[model samples]
Target: MRRFYSYLIYKLYTWALNGSGYNTPIFNVIVTLACVHSFQLIFLMFIAFKCLPANTHLSGWLNYVAILAILFLISHYYVFYNKERWEGYVKEFENETPKQSLKGKIYVLSYLIGSTIGVIWLMYFMSVYLFK
Candidate 1:
């Protein structure tokens, strides 16, 4: 089960990084969101497995908060180290031609929001099902 879970996470990360049909900026945003969400989920699972009391709801909640803190620290480090790359991506998108159609705009927005929300939902379900 552990190996399968690890493999699944690895595949998801790779897919997030290499997803098609988006510009660099959009891709970066997608990747960042994926990384953040996955990191939080995995960290929470680890904490729950290692530190939390088994069969306790409060412990699970505490594990969640600890995982969030850890993820925030990791995200801060990533943002600090990749500041230039992020800035460049934003600049590139800012200078690019705007999408001309409402459909295009809707598609882009939906893609971003949908993926983020989907990942969050998946993580929530996984945490609840696997840990509880």
Candidate 2:
């Protein structure tokens, strides 16, 4: 998980650096957002299906804030907390074969796309079934 996390951070950091020429803090936030969204889906899905006394509705703003806190911490560990760790990851894959690099990119892209679709589908399902 740490390896993949670093790779994802490196991928997003470089991409954001190229795309918008934003400074480091903005890129850090973008990476943090990606991590938050990835784990937030899992958290929501658990609430969707986990056994409980009853199907309960959470306050929308509260749910958002909780996930923002939990998963954001899980994702970035406070953006500026460990610059050495982030630097270690910055070029961790520099020596990889082209084939391996392509495969890694595919994995990252698939993860992003799958998590996004999962969230969209989960929202629709919740609205139609659970929240009804």
Candidate 3:
């Protein structure tokens, strides 16, 4: 459990840093805004779900799917942009030899998968609220 929390924190830090970049303070501000937006959405979804009426299972599931789709779309846009920056960073780091290692490939793959999961989770919560 401790390790999981550590990993989660690391991932969140990476997400913020990668999304915003370290070039300027504006990136940090953007990261903060993004975090706020994400958290607010989650909270709203939770409240919405809690207030949902009974016997709305089908509606709730549909809401979940729609929420997931929307979250995926939005997160994908941000993730892609962040990935471009990451690739640029990689290119800069390998300027001399221009080599791609297995670790690098794995890292990128994991980043994409993890981000997708995060978006999906967000959508699921929203759906529960929306449908309820």
Candidate 4:
């Protein structure tokens, strides 16, 4: 998990550094928002499975999602906005072998793709079951 977090930080920084005029803060926000979509899926599943144990309606879910979004945004920005913090992560993992780097890329890519699909599926399920 530590390695994954570092790699994610590194990748986010590398992207911000490479393109769109070196806007680290903005890119960090964008990347974090993208990842946070998966959090919605987790939240939805928790409610669906009774893990959250909430007795509320769609508006309640939306409120919880809004809070979760704010929390994730602040936390992600806090950890990643510090240059030294992410720079150290980059330095530590920069020496990765080509094979290891490729594996990391594949892992991150697959996770994002799978989570996106999961979110879509869950959203559809909610629309059919909850909205109707």
Q: Which model scores highest in TM-score? A: 4
- In model 1, what are the clashing residue pairs, if there are any? none
What shift in Å separates residue 71 of candidate 1 from its native position after superposition?
Answer: 4.1
User: Candidates' lDDT values, in order?
Assistant: 0.51, 0.66, 0.50, 0.66
User: Which regions of candidate 4 deviate over 4 angstroms?
Assistant: 20-22, 45-68, 123-132
Model 3 TM-score relative to the real fold? 0.30
Kindly indicate the candidate among 2 and 3 with the higher lDDT.
2
Instruction: Report the Cα lDDT for candidate 2.
Output: 0.66
Off by over 4 Å in 2: 29-35, 38-81, 129-132
Superposed by TM-score, candidate 1 places the C-alpha of residue 40 at a distance from the truth, in angstroms, of 7.4
Q: Give the Å error, residue 92, model 2.
A: 1.7
Candidate 3 stretches greater than 4 Å from native: 1-21, 59-132
lDDT tens per residue, model 1, 32-88: 555555655665566666555656656458776777767765674454345444444
Clashes of each: 0, 0, 2, 0
Query: Candidate 1, TM-score vs. the true structure?
Result: 0.33
Clashing residue pairs for model 4: none
**Model 3 score (lDDT):** 0.50
True-structure lDDT of candidate 1: 0.51
Q: In candidate 1, where is summed lDDT lowest over 10 consecutive residues?
A: 4-13
Which RMSD values do the candidates have, in order?
A: 11.2, 4.5, 11.6, 4.3
Give the TM-scores of the predictions, in the order they appear: 0.33, 0.62, 0.30, 0.64
